[model samples]
Target: MRALLTTGTPPTWTVTEIAPPAVAPDQVLVEVTTAGLNRADLLMREGAYVPSSADWNVGPDRVGFEMAGRVRAVGDRVTGIAPGQYVMAQTGGACAELVAVDHRLLLPVPDPQDLVAAAGLPSALLTEYDALTGAARFRPGDRVLITGGAGGVGHIGVQLARALGARTVIATTRSQDKAGLLRELGATRVIDTASEDIATALGPDAFDVCLDHLGGPVLAGLLGAAAPRARIVQIGRLAGTHAHLDLETLAARRIQLIGTTFRGRDTDELHALNARVREALPGLLRTHDVRPVVDSVLDLSEAERAGQLLDRPGLTGKVILRIVA
Candidate 1:
């Protein structure tokens, strides 16, 4: 088996031979076709976001969060899935030729033929769904704003909000070039943070909900821009953690500030989130109104290059790694 391993250093990834993962009774052994590169992978490699288990070797810490593949074998207890079934799953060992994933976390792949593009869908889409529906409780006709709209999760967040019937979708991106792309992804207005201030693009108290992928000063600005009784979901801190908030303003407007992260959830919680996402998968993909935005596809052996590309500023979407035959 070949996998992209992290060498416990910043901005580094290496492709090397490794043993295939052994399947548990509730797991399915998959022949991975593609893997999605995520920001978490970069952080974990840099030793910034360590999982609960601290003893695991960094080398085998295979770096990927999502994958699309064909099931090669299913454990005895695994039901509803069989060998040769194509699927997408949220799994840790995805930057490899083979991975064993819990059947509960797997979703059947859509009719589309490109498994590589499909690989980037699960994590980003599910995170956006959870942020919009689960955390923010967004309703139809709501005016929504999303920070980092050109990035992987932000791009999907913008589209999902529109699909869920948001009357107006506003997005913020540092790249002016991506403004048009964001509109194509369902944003009614795209704000180029490099040239325009979000507060200026959108008047004060204009949005019913704001999804912040970049915390710190940007997040504080988002909080200040919320409409009365607005709901703000904080999901990522790409800028930096620690942001000052105006408690008086938040209280006066009856605002709701909620913070969530999907990666650290317990098994049962993750199972529930996965199930909800699976139920919504058909409609999400079938409409073709909103799908994962794939920026580029690289061979499995080019994982380092993929990581570097993801790290570069002004990326408009996900970078996928093709892993299989």
Candidate 2:
């Protein structure tokens, strides 16, 4: 079997042959069709990102976080999935031709499989799902704000915010070129932070719920723009790790600043979270109003090209790695 590896001090992606993963009792063996690249993979390459316990392959292996494929086999204890079923999941070592993922992590791919598109959905879906529904405690008719609206997760966040019934869905992006796409994805307002000020563009007390991935100065702006008692869920620190915020506004508004990450979460916690997504999948998928925005599709050997896209400020949506059959 061919698997991707990350070797050297500052890791680099490599494709090599490795023993196929043995399916665990509660797992399913999937023949990967396509995989998605998240910005976190960039951190992993630089020895910055740590693997979640749920990730199957750690160390230097080409560690892809999510994929969409067809089920080749199922473990003894696995139920509700069968061979030939198309599925997608957020899992470790997804850069490989095959991966044995816990059945709980697998979500059925819509029929007439558009594996390329499905490839990009899981990571964004899971991250934003938990961030909005769990950390931010989003409710229907709440005015929602998603920073980095053109991003892999943010675009999905935009659609989810609107699909779930937000009164207003405002998305912020540095790429003005993506403003129209963000609006198409359901953002009521798209603020280009490259030229516009987030706080000034949105005004005071504008957002009832904020799902922020860019910390640093972007986060500081969110503090000023947030409504009283608003929940600001911090999901990533892409902009920077540090921020000088206004304690006065924070206190005055009685805002709840929440932080979330998937690193080091135990199997039980992951199972529960996956279940949360499954429970809401019906409503979220039934409308068919939400979908991942795919920017490009590359082969597994094109890992470097995929990784480099993360550095481009104009990059919009997910980069998928298609493993040609």
What's the TM-score of every candidate structure?
A: 0.94, 0.97
Predictions in order: lDDT:
0.83, 0.86
Give the alpha carbon lDDT tens digit for every residue of 59-162 in model 2.
54567899999999999998889899999888988888999999988887744368998889988998998888888889999999999888998899998888
Candidate 1 RMSD computed on C-alpha atoms after optimal superposition onto the true structure: 2.3
The predictions' CA RMSDs to the true structure, in order, are 2.3, 1.4
Off by over 4 Å in 1: 8-11, 52-60
Clashes of each: 0, 3
Tens-place lDDT digits, model 1, residues 125-149: 8788988989999898999999999
Model 1 weakest lDDT span, ten residues long: 51-60
